[model samples]
Target: MEIRKATEKDVREITTIYNEGIEDRIATLETEVKTDKYVMEWLFQREKRYLVIVMEENSHIVGWASINPYSHRCAYRGVGELSIYIKREYRGKGLGQNLLLALEKNGQQNEFYKFVLFTFSFNDLGQGLYRKMGYRKVGVFEKQGIRDGEHVDVMIMEKLLG
Candidate 1:
């Protein structure tokens, strides 16, 4: 598989991969499916620091990773929020790790000093991936959200980069 920077043409497949993560209800709180136009706008607007990396094999997009604004304030410009998702069928293949490592390297090149992400308490796989990458759990927002009438906690994780 090849890991590379995503272009406008890749938005649709990236959206598909992200929607799959949303549908699974394990990776994100966003339930609405995204459109290519929206993702395209995001890519253009944040292209300088934000990234969309895709893992491709045989011309099929198998996974993606992204970095977004952690905060809008100027003082927080050096920090970014990250997310990585792989196609459901590709989950066990370490694609997420490859995508994340690429993002980290890209982030450092872009002058980012820190990366942050949050995962649901029940998402052990995601948490383990973050831990293996040297991310530390800084805090937990207890009962921070409710989905399907069930309360869930969110773990906040961070990794420092020089």
Candidate 2:
């Protein structure tokens, strides 16, 4: 597999993978499937520090990762929010690790001092991956968001970067 910066051409696959995450109801709080146009703006219509990357194997995108602004306030400029999505069939095969490592490297290059992410409280697999990657579990937000008509708890994880 090859990991590289994401370009416009990869948006379709990226959107698909993200939709899979939504459909699975495991990774994000978003419930609606996204369109390519929406994904394009999201992936490209951001500052240089906010970056998106993709992993490809056999010329197909299997996963993606990105670093987003944690807050618009200047005080939080050094903090980046993390997002990672792997195709359903590709989950748990070490793909997220590769993407995350790349994102962390990119984050450091772009002046990010730390990275934070929120995941479903019941997402054991995702929590395991984050913990294995050196991210510490901070705490859980009760009833953070609604998923499938029920309030769900969300866990916050973070890692300080060099």
Candidate 3:
């Protein structure tokens, strides 16, 4: 697999992958699927502030990772909110780990001081991956959301970078 910076041409596939995450209801709080045009616009708007990368194998996108601003406030400029999504068929086999490592490398290179993210408390695999990646679980928001008619807690994790 090859990991590289994302370009406009990647928006469609990226949107598809992200929609998969939404459909799963375990990866994100977003419930609506994204459109290609919508994602393209988002990419353009965040091009300067975010680092987005995709993993391709045999010319097909299997996973993606991104570092977005934690907040618009200047005081949080060095903090980034992270996200990672892997296609369902390629969910395991270490792709998520690689994406996280790549994002960390890019984050530090870009002078980001830290990265943070939220994962559903019941997503054991995701939680384990974050822990294994050296991200500390800082807090939890109990019953922060409702998914599939059930209340879900969200775990907040952070990793300090140079």
Candidate 4:
């Protein structure tokens, strides 16, 4: 597998992978499935302004990772909110780790000083991956999200780049 920057043309595959995360209901609180229109717009904008990486194996997109703006304030300029998603069939294969490591490396090279993320407390796999990646739990938002009528805690983590 190879990890590389994503292009606008990748929106379709990216959207598919993202919607999979949505359907899983464990990675994100976003319930509305993304359409091509919305995904295209986001891809275009982030393409110029953020670190978006994709992992390909045998010429097919199997996973992706990105660093999104954490805030608009000047004080938060060096902070990025991290996100990662691997196709369902690709999970637990270490592809997600590779994508995230690539994304984080590129972010640091681009001057990002820190990475931050929020994961549903029940998402054990995600939390484990983040822990393995050297992220530290900074705080928690109790009952921050309700999915299927259950209150889900959100664990917030951060990793300062070297």
lDDT of each residue in 60-147, candidate 4, tens digit only: 8898888899998889888999889999998988887888788777888878999999998878898888899999999899999888
List per-prediction Cα lDDT, in the order shown: 0.89, 0.94, 0.90, 0.87
User: What is residue 160's positional error in candidate 4, in angstroms?
Assistant: 0.7
Looking at candidate 2, the ten consecutive residues that score lowest on lDDT are: 43-52
Model 4 global lDDT (CA atoms, 0 to 1)? 0.87
Worst 10 residues of 3 by lDDT: 41-50
Models 1 onward score TM values of 0.94, 0.98, 0.95, 0.95
Once fitted onto the true fold, the runs of candidate 3 whose alpha carbons sit more than 4 angstroms away are none
Q: Candidate 1 lDDT, tens digit per residue, 45-121?
A: 87567887889999989998899999999999889999898999999766788888899999999989999999998
User: What does the lDDT read for residue 114 in candidate 4?
Assistant: 93
Native-structure RMSD, model 2: 0.7
> What value does the lDDT take at residue 13 in candidate 3?
90
Model 2 clash pairs are none
User: What shift in Å separates residue 86 of candidate 2 from its native position after superposition?
Assistant: 0.2
Winner of 3 and 4 under lDDT:
3
Comparing candidate 2 with candidate 3, which one achieves the higher lDDT? 2
lDDT of 4 at 75: 94
Ranking by lDDT: 2, 3, 1, 4
Residue-pair clashes per candidate: 0, 0, 0, 0
